[model samples]
Target: MFDIDRWREIFQSINKNRLRSILSGFTVAFAILLFTLLFGIVSGLSNSFKSAFADDAQNAMFVRVWQTSKPYKGLQTGRTIQLKNDDFNYVKDEYESKIQYQSARIYKNFTLKYKNEANSYSVRAVHPDHQFLEKTMIDEGRYLNEKDLQEKSKVIVIGRLIKADLFGEKPALGKRINVNGSSYLVIGIFSDEGGDNEERLAYIPVTTAQMIYGNNDYISQINLGYNPDLNLDEAISFGKQLERDLRFKLNIHPDDQSALSVRNMAEANKNVGSFMAILYAIVILVGSGTLIAGIIGISNIMIFVIKERTKEFGIRKALGAQPLSIVWMVVQESVFITTIAGYLGLSLGTYLLSLIGDSLEEDYFIKDPSVSTGIVVGATVVLILSGLIAGYIPAKRAANIKPIEALRAD
Candidate 1:
């Protein structure tokens, strides 16, 4: 019920032993603070890992060629390996069912001129599906279509930063820009989550680059996204199979990674997912240990406090106080201390995480450290329950003591 007198007694008792109460409360607070910080930092690490792959489609794979590092079939080391339109056609024909989206890329650097404004930017000649593989978002107009690739159209799509630099408040769409002296129409402007370097690029049709740059059918790399219906293991197996087949077709040694390599997003994603799961499990174990230690510390303090007040409890019993009243008072005090202290710890930890923000992203790969609302609520419940248990045990034992024996306690 509404027992103001009981509350007054509890408050008076707490005031009488301020040092003991502070010490108990501090133990709980520090444990909760440590728990919060640990979880928040791990969550930040998870965020960093996710953002690292945000630039590309989860199922994307890349096939790259470079100079041979090992001799194979009488061919000497250091021979430059090259990918061509025929190789791209071979992949498309061989894995038509397994492929979702495919693109051939040819890298170039061109000085783009829009009237007086001019700057050098990285250019990629690619197929239409390159947009999805790169996760490029078109802000205006449209990306390259099959018609552009077939017609070898002199149409280009520029990045958001490129548009801003060359156009500067002017509409870049439908405007003609000179690229290495040749005029090309800007069909679209796009942005990428891959950061500034990605946003400063321009893309044209791969066929156009092949026709104009070298008058030959040469490509720098091939990118493809596996069918989303395939599971991770299946996707990985597909990538390996494709890689081995490509090595055989290109006359490169099976172990010669420098000659030809396939980079599979599926393998990277699986490894990262496993790593994060293990990390979270470890953090949860450590956090639970901290909470248990806090509970034990408070329990010990309560036992000591009850022992010290045994004589007082005996006097109250001699004066006709109920055992229930004694237990209730002690439990109330414990709960009060734990609740307030836990709240303070939670608040302080969250504030510290907010202050951390993205400051650790560059060096530690920790981004936007934080704990979830459900976790906070769960922690609060645990603290309250622990307080109740801590108080109940010692209070029960003290209440049961005979008045004479309790009175004799020193």
Candidate 2:
């Protein structure tokens, strides 16, 4: 209902007590502002963590070996540990059920030249399944196939940035690029969300690298994606078991991490999951506390305002004003102040978050911090309801007072 008279009265009351209204509104606004910033920052941090691991498949694991740090059986410290085709085959055959995708990696640094444009890029020779393990997206042409490995084909998959650098606007697929001194066909152009470093590298068949580069079965690392059906705990357990078996088979000390180690994405995921859970819980608590404080502050202010207006309320009652009208007026005024103040706080918080976009990513790992619309609306609704309650309780009591007694409230 359009009640102009009622609205006019509310405006008059607010105008008369500007300082009191501002104080009440300030409390609510400050609380909401704090709540918004806390949640937004935490959300950004969560995003950063997720993107940090985005380079590899969530189920991926890497087996890397280096020079031994501890003596084992008859072997002395500093013994060089090398992963070979045999070690890769052992994992593939033994843990076939536990593994989804498997690839052996051999690292190389080679200068790739297409016509006159040339640049040195990191090259990784890997099995076909390496594409999935690294989450590499084929933008054009196809990744390495089994035939390439068997035939030791001189073919390579270049990254998006590599193509840009070497081929410019020209198409790179099916073109021949000089690698080191040998000419290799470009089978694919790929992109990676892992960022520019990944996009500057290239991949070739593991056999091709072994045959041309070293003529040996030596591999740099073993990469595998655990079966996606397994839960984090199960995947982590499988990784640990595999690490132990590989260590025993290689005759390395069981505790020698440098000699044999498996970097499991599952363990990292679990730790991150736990950390986010705790972080969200803490934010909920602190946000809730701030809101409660706001509600309490408004409640106290409303009580005082009602006290100050008791004599006026009695005079109006004496002049035939209904008790419900008095209660409604106070409730309406409370809701208006809280609603406007809350909106201002929400807007300020959102604007601050937008300004902070990616600025904290490098140092603090907070990215794109902001609250969802539903949550902001929900919080606003809560504040409105709290204001209604704060006004109703005291106004109702004051409305029910006998006119003479209310007039004598002083």
TM-score of each: 0.87, 0.90
Residue 301's lDDT within candidate 2 is 71
**Which candidate wins on TM-score?**
2
lDDT tens digits, residues 33-142, model 2? Answer: 88788889888988888798888999999999999999989999999999999999999999999999999999999999999899899999999999999999999999
RMSD of 1: 3.1
Candidate 2 to truth, TM: 0.90
* True-vs-predicted CA distance for residue 210, candidate 2, Å: 2.4
State the lDDT at 74 in candidate 1: 97
> For all the candidates, what are their Cα RMSDs to the real structure?
3.1, 2.6
Candidate 1 global TM-score: 0.87
The count of residue-pair clashes in candidate 1 stands at: 0
Residue 202 Cα positional deviation in candidate 2, in Å, after optimal superposition: 0.6
lDDT score, candidate 1, position 383: 79
